[model samples]
Each structure stands twice: as C-alpha cells, then as structure tokens.
Target: MTPTSIRPFPRWDDARAATLDEPGLLLYRSNLLGSDLRITNYGGGNTSAKIRQTDPLSGETVEVLWVKGSGGDVGSMKLDGFSTLYMDKLRDLKKLYRGLAHEDEMVGYLPHCTFNLNSRAASIDTPLHSSLPYAHVDHMHPDAVIAIAAMAHSEAITRQVFEGTVGWLPWLRPGYELGQRLAEYDAAHPGLRGIVLAGHGLFSWGDTAKSCYENTVDLIERAQGWLAQQREAKKVAVFGGPAVQALPEPERDATLARLLPVLRGLSNEGAPKLLHLNTSAEVMEFVNSADLAPLAALGTSCPDHFLRTKIRPLIVPEAVYTLAGAELRAALGGLLAAYRADYAAYYERCKRANSPALRDPNPVVILLPRIGMVTIAKDKATARIAGEFYVNAINVMREANAVDRYVGLPEQEAFDIEYWLLEEAKLQRMPKPKPLVGKVALITGGAGGIGQAIARRFLSEGACVVLADIDAEALQGVEAELAKAHGKDHVRGAVCNVTDEASVIAAFDRAALEFGGVDILVSNAGIASAAPIDETSLALWNKNQSILATGYFLVGREAFKVMKAQGSGGSIVMIASKNGMVASAQASAYCAAKAAEIQLSRSFALEGAPLGIRSNVVNPDAVIRGSKIWTGQWSAERAAANKVDEGDLEAFYRERSMLKRSVFPEDIAEATYFFAAEHLSAKSTGNILNVDAGNLAAFTR
Candidate 1:
C-alpha cells in the first residue's frame, strides 16, 4: 500500500492555539476533526484533553479531563458540551471496576468524578479517553480507518499500513475492560501513537492538543492513502462492479416519487417515519453493484452505523423495477413482511434474559437496484443521518474488500449493542414526541398569510410541511423564512398551480419526496372578487372557480390519492370564507366559489369517512390584515361595496360583526389546527368552524 494524493491535511494554526486555553484548544481540535465527515461522523466520536484548572471549590490547581459529553455532536457543540472529570478520580475508578460483566456500572461512577459540578454527562467512551497515557486523546469512527479495522486481517493490515506507528486490538465492546486493555497496550508498545480497535474505530493520542488532532488526521489519511493504493494495485472492481445500470435521473426520481409513499405507509404501522432518499454517486454505484445483496447482508462493521441504520437494509427485488400500482404495492408489502419476520426471528435468537424488548421490526434503510437508497426514521434529520451512516459503511466495505475481505460485527455482538441497557436508558430519557410529530402537511396556498401561519403552527408541533403556492417568488421566500425559523429539514416549497392537475400532483409528489406522505392537507388557495350578479362576467366567474373551487378540488384529490396509498388516516382542512354560508352583497363570483369549496369539503368528508380521512372547513370573514386578497383591488372593492373609506374597511367589518371583532390569519390557522390534530378532533369531521367574529347569517344552524 502506498500513499494517495487526496488526504486530510492538518489545519492547526499556532496563533489560534496560542489564543485558546487548554480546554478551548481541545474544543478547537474536536471541531476541526468533526468538521469533515471523512474524519468522523456526527456524534460518532469523542475527544479529550487533560487540562490543569483551578478547582472551583478548592483554590488548588488540578488535572481535569474535558471530553465530548454523551449524546453531543462535536461539530456543533459549545464549550458546555464537554464533560469535566477529575483525572485522579477517574484513575481511582479502577478500584471499583470489578470486571467486564459489570463495566456498565462504571458510568454511574462518572458523576462522582465530575469536577466543578459540571453536569454534562460523560459518554461510554470516557474510559477509553481517560485510560490513555497521553494528555490529549481522540476516538474517531473514520470510514478509512474503520475500513482497515473491519478487515478480516485487520491487525496485520494495521501493522502493514502504519509500520508499527499504530497498534491494533481485537474487537471488544467499549467499556472499562477495553479501556484497561488500551492502557496495557500503550504500556507494552512505548512509541505507538494510536490503536485501531478491530471492528470498531481508531484511538489516537498526543502530548499536545494540536499533536493529538494531527495524529488522528494523519492516521486516517494514512489508512485512506493505503486503501487508495491497494485499490489501484489490485485493480479490483468496486462491489464486484455494477450489476445493473442506474435509471436516468428523471425516471429514477419518478420511481422514487411512486415508491416512497408505499414504503412510508408500510413503515407507519406503529409510529410514522419520515423518509430520506440519497442518490449520490457512491450510493448509486453501491445499489447498482452485483455484490450489493451479499455485502449489504454482511451488515455494517461499526456499532455507530448499525445503531442508526439497523443491522441490515431491505433490498428491493428486480421485479420492483417492472411493477406499478397494485402490483408494485403488493410486492413491496410481501417484502416488508418477510423483512419484519426475519428481524423478529433475529431478535428472538439474540435476546438475553434481561435484553430490551424487540424494537420496530421494519428496516430503517431500503435499497433499490437502479434508483437509490431510502432511509426512514422519526424525523427528516435522523432519516438523512441514517442514510449518511450507511454511505460511510459502503465506503468501508468498498475499500476493505479491495485489500481484504470485509467483515461485519458478529450478529450476537450487533444485537448486544443494539439492545444495550445503557442505550435503552438513554433513549428512554429523550423528550416525549410533540402532538404533530412525524406528520406531514401540504398547504396549497402556502405563500399566503393563512398558509404561512398554519405552517408555522404545524412546524412548532413537529410536523414537516410542503408549502405549495402558485407564486414562485413568494413560495421561495416563505420556504426560506419557515425553514430558518423551524429547520431546513422540516419545510420545503413547491411552485404549484393548484388549478392544473399535473401541477397539483407534482406538489403532492414533492410532499412525498420531502416527507414520506401527506397526513394533513390545507386547501387554502383562494381569490376574491366583488361584482353584482348582473355585472359578473364569465371570465371573472371562471377565474374565481379555477383558483378557489377547482384548485381546492385538484389539491384535495391529490392528497387523497397519497393518503390512501399510504393507508394512513388523513385530515383535510378547507379554508373557505364566511361568504360560503351567507349571501354577501356584490361579491357574486367570490361568494359562489367559496360556497362551492364548502360543499366540496362536505362531499369529501362523506367519501373519506370510511377510510378514516377527515375533511372540515374554516370560514374566516374580513381577514384584511396579512391577506393576499386584501393587498390587491379586493380591499377597495370591498370598501366600496360597504360604502366606507378603504382605510376604514377593517373598522367597518369589525363594527358590522355581531361581536364587533376582526378576523386574522392566525385565528383561521388555530381553527384549522384543531381539525388537523387527530388527538384534538379525531371524531369531528365535515364540521364547519366559523372564525368570523360572531356572524349571525354564517351560523351553521
């Protein structure tokens, strides 16, 4: 193996290091390493520095181990993310360590070693860092090093690659025992800089923070270079070369648009899961490879990888490429059943007396030969991260198989990690799911005030949203604003002319691709016009019907298709107007269109009831503020009809109401939210909620 051209270079600056204290330097090093995915995955590594600090209680200086805390991502973490423990107390923990069987108990003892009352919980990798002899330490799950570490001849390969600069240790579940073994190995090999933990990760150290960061990078670079050389020298085809060609981008996306909803539907049996699709060059190559099934069957080598992606992914059959509609769904259903059964059997085979109960049996990842990989999880970020972890696993396998046969962690070992009591406890401590968590909503007039308000409300409750509006510029701005306020993963924008069937379908497809499928549909796209029945032209009537009535129908119809395919109950909220149920003067076209919307919603409710789909209407009158309709000529038109100044229209509407109160987008949003939230109004369908400041004529009675 020879060095490759592309390698991670040290980014340490003496000036930067000089300004930062020892702890800050440690953070700097961790951030630098974590900034590159090629170095370490998100929350998949730990770093520490034994810094001299003045004890908060005692005035004396002491050594404190500042390490990446449990469940924190180094790249985005602040100073508070590090757990500080007394070095002397950590060393003293060896006395409490009875054996490997009781190693998990050591975690409880970590708080006792906490210095200065720092409450950040120490990670399981704490022992590995504290046990190292060096002042600075890093434990990283870099794909390159893990490639060597996961090889059948890992130890020999480590020796050959590093020429004794790096050492090797056989696979051990990370705990007190592994830490002790590391310390022993360091003592035996006086000059080694790091040790590659077989089937796990790499542990590197240095006398200084900079050196430790550099050493970690150097080792990973060396492994990457060696693998690159080996691949070149051996000239072995990756994943036994491509067995099938990838579909063209358009066709592939179309296939994904069709398949994702069905997959999401199947996965929603228990808790709903969001799906993420990856079609990067690497993913495309791997999924199209001849050895995809066999390599994927071997599972992931690193515990961090499988913990998110599961032990293995479900590979779609070749017939999937040829099937459509019911045939496609049936084939996928059968595949899912087999995958779940196999997972259940594996759980049974691996369960210990005290093991955690079986988890969701559905695979987190699904691979299609000519398309790409789809990862499903509770939310978008987790699903995306799961896909990334699998991609890293692919890289490891590609390189490892080039040099030597790759091996996954043993099945029993993988199960032990997956069902570990500590991991289970950590999960149990996570915050409860929000009311709308894992639900996806598509808003037809998402750029409008009502749509934006509803989106913000839904996002606050943890639902992913696809904002579809005919106004592309407004849609983009709203998408950006919402994404910034919520998160980029939770909001997406689609420029959709809801009146066009293809555009409406495309918007729903966007929703399916962005989230998994639509659980809630808000048909809010509308237009306002004021014309006497004698003066109303056919064009005005058609325009009003096209946007308000016809548009709602198209969007609602698409939503039903997706929801039905998902086999999950859905909620449809139509943003009709108070005029829908009342005769408004000189607004024949607008009132008629809104009336059509109300009737259409009731029809939908009747048809969808048996399928557990709910349809309801929110009637808001005189929403002059933040309304797109009011921003145009409709305001003057309404004011003229009411015989009031344009500026006094709001006051006029307020005075005209029975309650003399005004309506706003937020009020309408609240009403819509009630209908969409199943826990709030699961049994109340086909109902009309009036947010009209107490209008007598618009009353349902």
Candidate 2:
C-alpha cells in the first residue's frame, strides 16, 4: 500500500468567511464550487451543510441544506460555495409521490426539495441530502473511484463487497433519478448515511464537511484494501507511475485568489479561507486518464449534487493547460454551441410532451485529462469546494469499484428533474396562459379602443390577430401599424357586419384558413346610444341590439363551431362596459345590450369549461381616446351637442374611475394579453378581469 499525502485546501479570513452567512452568497459559492469540482480536469466533487434551527416560538425543528454551488471545484472553496434549502420542505415533497394521482398536478410545479428562492438552482442531490436527516452533506468522485467504477465488472464486484451495506444504485443518468434513487434507498434502509453507485462513485454525509471528509477517507481505504488484495493474488500492476504535469500551485493559487471574493459574494457575507488541501498522484492520474469516454458519460454522483456540481465533468489534458487561455476559449465556444442545440432540442421535445424546460445545459465542471483538476469558480473559495467533491467522488468510486459499476439515472428522468416545477417555481411563479397560441382571433370592431388593444396584445404574445370593423378605413389603419410592427403575416384586417351571420361566418372562415384555426373569439362590435330612456326609440333599440348583442352571439357561434371541430379548447373574450354594471342615465338600450353581452360571457365560461374552452370578459372604463365611440367626444359638433368645454372633456372622463386618470390603450392591451397568454390565464374559465381602475361600484352587484 502506498501512503499518499493530502493537499492543503485554501482558506479565507474570518471577515471574508462571514460573507457566507448570507443564503444568496452561500448558494452562489456552492454552485460554482460544485461545478468546479466536476469540471476541473482533476476535480469532480461537491460540498453541503445542513442548517438546523429550532423555531423561536413553535420550537419545531427546521433544517436546510446550505450546499456548495455548481460550476466550480473545491480547491478554492469560499463561504459562497453553498445553497440554503429547507429540509422539511424537501421531506414534504417526498410525501407527494405517495398520494393518489398527484403526478399531473405536481408535475412542473411540485417542490423538488425545500424551495430556495435565493439560489441559482437547487442542488441536483437536494432530495438526497434533505432526506438524510443530517446537518451536512458532501459528495465527490475521486480518481481512484472513477478508475474502479469505470471497469466492466464494476457493478458485480461492488455488490460482492458492499452488499446490504452502503446503498448501491445502477447508473440512472444524473439529476432527478440520482437524488430520488438514493433518497428512496436511504429511506428504505433508514440507517445508511452513505451510497456507493455502481460505475459511478460515492455519497457521504455528516454533521460537517470534516466528518464527511473523514468518512470519505475511510471508504477510500476499504476500496484500496480490496484492490490491494486483488493485486496480491494476480500480481497486478502497482500505481508507481511517473509524475504528470499539474496546475502550478503558485499560478493556481493566484487564479484561485482572484476567484475567492466572487465565491464569498455567492456563499456568505464574509470571505472564506481554505484548509486541508489534498492534491495527490491518484487525483492527477485519474484526471489524466487515457480513456475519458466512460468518464464523459458518468453523470454527477447524485441529483442535488448538480446544484453543487453540474451534470458533466470538465476534461483537461497536459498541454490543455499550457494553452489554458486559448483552449478554454475554444472549449467554451464548443460547449455553447452544443449546449444551445441540445437545449433547443430538449425544449422542443418537452414542449411537445408538455414537460418543463431546464435553465441551462453547459457543463459546469471542466475535467482536464491532466495538469491536476483545476477547479474554476466565480471565486476561489467555490473552486476549492468543487475540487473537494471531485476528490470525494474519486475516492468513493475507487472503493465502490471493488463491488459494482456505478450506475446513474436515465436521461429522460434527468430531464424531469432538471425541469422539475418545484425547483422552477422557486425562481419565478407565473400563471399559465390561455390555450390559444397559433390560434386565430377575429375581433369585431377591433379597430376600436378595446378591440384594437386586444388585437395588439394578442399579436404581441404569439397569436394571429385579425382586426375586423365596420369602418374599413380604421381597420386598414390598424392593419398597417400592426403589419409594420409584427409583419403582414401576423396582423390582418377585414370589413364585416356582426349583425349578418353570413358576413360573420365568412370572416371566421377566412381567419381559420389563414391561420389554420380560429381559437379565440373577441366579441366587441357595438354601437352606443346614449339617448335618455324617454327619448330611446324602437329604431334605436333595434340598431343597438342587432350590432352589439346579436353580433356577439353570431361571432361566438362561429368561433365555437371552428374550435370544437378542431378538437382543441378555445377562448373567447367579450368586452363588456362598466356602464353595464350599474345603470347610467340616457343609456337604456345600450345598457340592455351591454348587460346581455356580460351574461353571454358567463354562459360561455360555463359551457366552454367542459370543452377546454375558456370565456372571459374585460370590463374597461374611461379608455375613449382610441375608441370610435369616444372620437365623437372630440368632434366640434360633439362638444356643442354635449355643451361641454374642450379642456373639460379630457378631465371629465379621467375623473370617472377611482384612480382619477385616463386609462391608456396599452393598459387595456396588457389585460387582453393576459387573457391570451397561457401562463397568466390558464385556469380562468368564466373569469371576468376588470381593467378599470378600482371601480367598486362597477365591480360588484
């Protein structure tokens, strides 16, 4: 047996270490550190700590994982090399899988571990660590471990040695499966604090990094003993290899120093200092392996480990660092290209399968074949932590190799974990949009204020919006502007009479033919008759009913026919006025028609719910500048007719709402956009959104 000396790990001053007290900085450092570990040519490992606290009032115990980050190694670890996560929260997530049919509901929205809002992303092994019931968790893949795990009989051999001892998982890929499998196995065993993955590496945890590191060393010794026994029987070659070129400590130290502050900024409030550094021949040999093919396929030791160390390791060779600057630049370019392409493909397939998308795909860790594993970090502290994980993984794999091959999770499962909703929700929570993309929307009187706004917003959010109005000139104007902005293919204009079924049907048919489907119906064509009830004539009533009320019904019927036949749920937006809520003087017929439109929206909501169709209404008030109805207010004759002063007209409408301000067309547009975006209004069937500024009187009965 050979006696190998451990390298000295870097450290930070107390003041700098204090920076890691901050959860945000801790996560940043941990992520970079972990990434550096896996990516460093000679590095591939990660670090984590559990923060346990008793609630001041409830006295309930709370635990969180302050894990080292991804994208860096451990050699230059800093306080920032940690991500804080709620342990209890992660435990609760494990409970969901036990429930009945909660899969769909929990799909992308479910919590991975405890959700951490301040981290770049939760550690891939978050579940594994959280499930441990420990305060600290650290993982790594030492060169010794990698050598053994990568062997053909690794799995069978691993089983023979560690049977029923440390949990063994066949390679399942990385990310979700690694976390889930280890967690599941640990839960089943209840007492196991470590996992040996066949053809992979190892997982060790403790109350602190030191404890975990010690346990790691113990595991390494066991594997070394087993290997020594095998060698004695077979006279196997001993590891008396020639020294290889390594990353010069002076240069490495300087590079690491430059990275420390960034690590501090990511992990804690204070800077961090390194300690117990370990650079060995085993580490260098493993880093400079002749065949990196299998290493390239090996995923991170565990899922949550990805939060600390990314999916793949960074491979570095001897001359690789000689041209370090140039090589890194070239590698980054290649990685970016591969990443973007892979990500795009993954996103497209996931979208097709209704799956979530991952944040990024670049390998956080670089595994240079030689020159020692250089743990790159946003800062030095993180780089050190990453390097530590690399060492750990290497050690574990060496021991586990005597038993079995380290197996990872499957790719599909990995994607599921990468796109896990629970993790994503922590970043940003937004509602799903209405199901209407690539769907054509034909708005009657779309050139008017509300209609035009709806059209513009829909088009902006990936819908084919058609502006239809009785005023040909106005429709053309909107068409021209939208075409100029979004292109002619996206915005269309047509002249149609809502009162005539043939005209209404033809417009819908044209829209469908052009856009391949008519999924959204915006019924907003109407004439306002503000004459007093006593002065309201039968002719006026007929005109208003025919255009506003009957017109809406005709459009809705046509849209329904198109959407139902297409076998896709559709959406309809009815622009009802605030005037319809409470009565207004001299608006009897107009009020009756508007009231009917509002009810129509409610009915659509109910009927459409069963068919995946959503019906909603936007109640907007005081947005008249762009509305045809308000154009008359600015006319010379209108001023004379109303007997109001010119300057007072603008103020008059502005004072109508509680906000005492005129609503812009853009405001109404934004509201309409919500109705069309699947994220904002996915579950809003029969919903009515008020675009008016705080109209208590208008909102409620």
Candidate 3:
C-alpha cells in the first residue's frame, strides 16, 4: 500500500530559521512548527533533536537529546527552553529502572539521569524521543489528527488513511513502557513514516529537523482531509425533543452576569479560578448536541489534555436558567457538590490501579449550553490556554463522530497519566508564584505617572488591571504599554472622571466586565491647588475638592459596592497626601480636601471590616515624577508658599525627610501593595502608610 504523504517538505532555509547554531535552529524549527494554532495550540507540543557534544571537563564526545523543556512554549522556546539530556544515560535508565509504580515517581527518576548540573528539567517525554531511531523528532497534538485517532475503530481508519504506512499503538500511559512499545513498533514496521497513538497524538521523525516537521504536517493534513470527506458524507441525527428551559436572548448576558461570579469563587483547594465565556458556533453546536451528556462524560480525547481540561467537563444543561437568586445559588452549589462527589468516586475507582494523591475536584471546562463555554484557571494565561484546548477538543469530538462513535482512552488509563510524575511536574514546577495571580485591581488615575506605575506593578504580579482616567489618549497609551508586558486581555483602559458618579460606576462596571470581578481599588486621582485662605475662591476650592476628595468617594463607593456583591472581600487603597496629615501654609483648599479624603477612607474601612474589605491610605509627599500636580502655575504657587525655588523643591522635601531619600511613585506603589496583601495586613485597616521618605513633619502626624 502507498503511503499518504500529503504535503511537500517545509522550506527551512537559514533566512527563514533566523539561526545557524544547532540549538537555535532547533528552537526556530519548533517555533515555526508550533506556530499554527490549529495544528499545535500554544504550549502543548514538543520537538527534539539528537546531536553530539563534547564535555568540557572530560573532553569526550556524548550524544545529547535536546528536547523542549518543561513549562515553555515551543513557539517561543530558546536555548534555555531545550533541556540538554545525555542520551546514553537516559537510554541506560531502562536497564536500572525497577519500573515506576506511580507516574509522579518519574520526577525523581528523570533528574537522576540528567548530565548537566545546571540543566533545566528535561521534558518528561525525553525517553520517548530518545527511543526513536532518528536524529530529529517532532510530536504534536493536531486537532484533525486527534479527531481521527480518538474515534472507535481508529486503528482501522489509521490503515485506510495512511495505507499501513504508520503503526497504531493503543493507549499506553506514557513512560518507560510507552517508550519500549515505540521502540518495538519501530523495529517491526519497516519504512514507517510515523506512528499514531490511539486517543493521544502523533510522532514523526527523520534524518533532519526539516524532514521531521514536513512529515508531521504531511500526515496531519491527510488526516484533516479524510475527516472532512467523512464529515461531508455523514448525516447527523438530532434527538426528537426540544431543549428544556430555553433562555430568551436578553437573558443570556444577565445570566452570565449572575452566574459567572459564583463560578469564579475560591474553591476549598485554595485555587483562585477566573472564567472565560466561549460563544463560538462550534462550541454552541456541541453544547446543544443530543449526545452532549454521554459524549462529554467520555473523558478528553487525550490524557495530555487532562491538566488543562479535567477528566470531564461540567455540562450545565439549559434548564439551569430556570433557577434564580438564592435558589440559583443553591442549585449551582448542588452542581458543584455533585461534581466533587463524582470526582471523589472516580478517584476511588482508579486508585486501586494508580496511586497519586488526588488533585482539586473542580472541573476546568464548564459548558453553559447557549450561554457559552466557561474555562476556570488561576490566571489569564492559563485560562486562555485551557479554553483553547477545550475548543480543540470540541472539534475533535465532532470530527470523530463524523466517522464513527467518538471515544477516548479508558478512565483508568487517563487517570494514570494525569497523576503521573511528568504530567504533575508540568504544573507543580511553576515560576515564582506571583502575589496577585487571580486578583483584579482598578486605579482611578491610571493614565498618570504614579497610577500607571502602580498598575504595572500589580500587572507584573499577575493581576488583571483596569486603568481609569479622564485622559482617554493617555489611558490608551498606558493600556498599550501594560498590554505589551502583560497580555492585551489582562490590561484595560477606561475614560473615567472620579468626580462623576456615573463615570465611577461605569469604570467599576468595566472591571467586572473585563475580569469577572474587582479585588483591589487604588483611588489615586486628584489635583493640587495652592492659595491663601482669603484668596481661595468657591470655584477653585470646589474644583480641588471635587477631584481630590469627592473623586475618591465616588470611585471607592462604586468599587466597594461591586466587592460587596461579589461576596469576595477586597481591598481599597486611597492615595491621600502628606498635606492631609499636616497643615501646609497657603494650601488650605488642598490640605482640607486631602484630609477629607483620608477621613472618608477611614469610614469606608469601618463599613468594610465586617465584610473582610480592607481600606488603607497611602500618604505620599510630592511624588513628582509623572505627577502633573507640580507643573506650570501650581509649581510656582507651591514654591512660593514653601519659600523655595522650583528646583530646590525636590531637595527640600528629600532633605527634610528623616531618611533624606526621594519618595518615588514606585515607593508609593510598594505601600499600596503592602496594604492590599490580605495575608500581610488581614487584621490591619483604616491605616496610613506614609511613602514620603520619612517626612517627620507629615509622618502620620
């Protein structure tokens, strides 16, 4: 039988690859190969190359397997992302291995075989790549390929598509055993182009990286073509009855508004989950399918997807729309309880065969019929990836049904890999855990210098940040800057005047709409005014008070309202100034309004105490950078009132401080973070954190 080589080899010239070095070329190849989201969704696939390297100390040649490292995306992988494993040592582990009883134990087994002391943790599938008799190997979970591979009689379809050019291996939990099976299959099947793992993914190899990648694209394109043909010829059968409790068009967002908050709550597992609503046509089709219940209950198409998408999704039938308020909350709680209970039962059923402690019982993917699919995770990046994998799984299931009944690995098989050392290691070996992984922060003066710095700090710590300012252009610029560092979805900009009640409400509403809820508020918007008490006019005084004090009240009020309704206690950081704590000469309006802002914050702290809401004031003195408060006429007035030159103002404030250090916007940001930290300041509220470089006159006077 002729082999189905669908596409020609990919052109990987030096110009296209961007590098000529062995490792850099491999990274370039992996990136290009994994760039296609439909073929290899970000961070899910791997590539490896075999090369000879000389040990600097011993000066002996060694075979090295440079596989994609753990926790790194192939599309953006670099030299560091490829863990260098000594191939001879990895191959020799098979002889000493007493066989792994549980999957997690392989973590210990793997590091013990690494050749370099400072090497990153190798990809857990190093052995699988090492066993293949080729210089290069590319492995990917293409949706179209999985569609065909996950169907019942997938082996028969495999023969039909490739004409017996590729070998079909039934579900084997990946490890030493799977590695040995691949080696055995390679020996038996001569002239094999690739091997299709039933209910898993594909592995293709060649003498060069280009050939290996080309072969992968070839086989996947053929599988996609075959699945398309099958889908066109097949007729779908719909169930006779209509869906129960159908929701009207107007009620969909309303339902999401009500239910998403509950779904984004903290589980007993200590995991902070955020939700993404998926409303694509493909998702809706699967959500409304007649076999939605049974098909979804059949587990994921591959165990590799187990971490992103749990064993099974939480398929919320349309009938859930019938429940409301307390009744709705109770019903949702009951659904969670049922899911947890079923997961516990599944653990018990599978534990007899595989022993690893159980992970959180909450499902990652929640199907909401016509409403949309919801993906829950601890951060935006993870949630987005999880959601993408589910959509891929949905397409696979649909395509699988086109040819035959969609099927996946047996429950026990999926359980073994999901709990295995390699799979568990992929998640457990995280980067330095950010303090605000799932938290949402809103800054009122976000388009300004100090406010944007605070937003950047929170964003770096993994918080979704909303920037609200009257300057729409600056807001857009700041948002763009933040989005470059964090993802575009994690940073949002809204034009809001804290002096306007409606604007404040709209700002907080944007936060809830962008990220399901708000967890922190930095009320930092204000203007500075300087004048003798007699010269301070009503209009001047009112403008200063409106922005400096009333603005804080308006924004803080809206933020607290949302925080209270979320029932998930949050923090409110008021950006008051030193003028509030100490009397300033010729600055009656500024001093009075700032003092009022601090008092308002103290009042808010009292109201929020019973609800676990924390309110604190960060009183910073003349944080001049990016601060327009001291520019133009205000600068002259301030200098005259203080009897100092404009240039001397910086030194005057810094030298006057107990520490003689300049107070920066970042310094103020640090103080806000301190108060925002629940673990650090859980019992402390209505407190003033002075970020004034130790201003004795205004140090919490």
Which candidate number maximizes lDDT? Answer: 1
Q: Rank the candidates by lDDT, best first.
A: 1, 3, 2
Global fold similarity of model 3 (TM-score): 0.90
* Pairs of residues at least 3 apart in sequence or in different chains that clash in candidate 1: none
Candidate 3 structure quality by residue, lDDT tens digits, 87-146: 877787777656555433554667766666647887667778888888998878888778
CA displacement after TM-score superposition, residue 73 of candidate 1 (Å)? 0.7
- Candidate 1 lDDT at 696 equals 88
Model 1 misplaced stretches (Cα beyond 4 Å): 1-10
Model 2 CA deviation exceeding 4 Å by range: 1-437, 633-646
- Go through the candidates in order and give each one's C-alpha lDDT: 0.91, 0.58, 0.79
**Error of model 1, residue 248, in angstroms:** 1.6
By TM-score rank, best first, the candidates go 1, 3, 2
The stretch of ten residues in a row with the least summed lDDT in candidate 2 is: 267-276
Considering summed lDDT, which 10 consecutive residues are worst modelled in model 3? 237-246
Query: Model 1: per-residue lDDT, tens digit, 170-262?
Result: 999988899999999999999998999999999999999888888888788888888888888899999999899988887877777788888
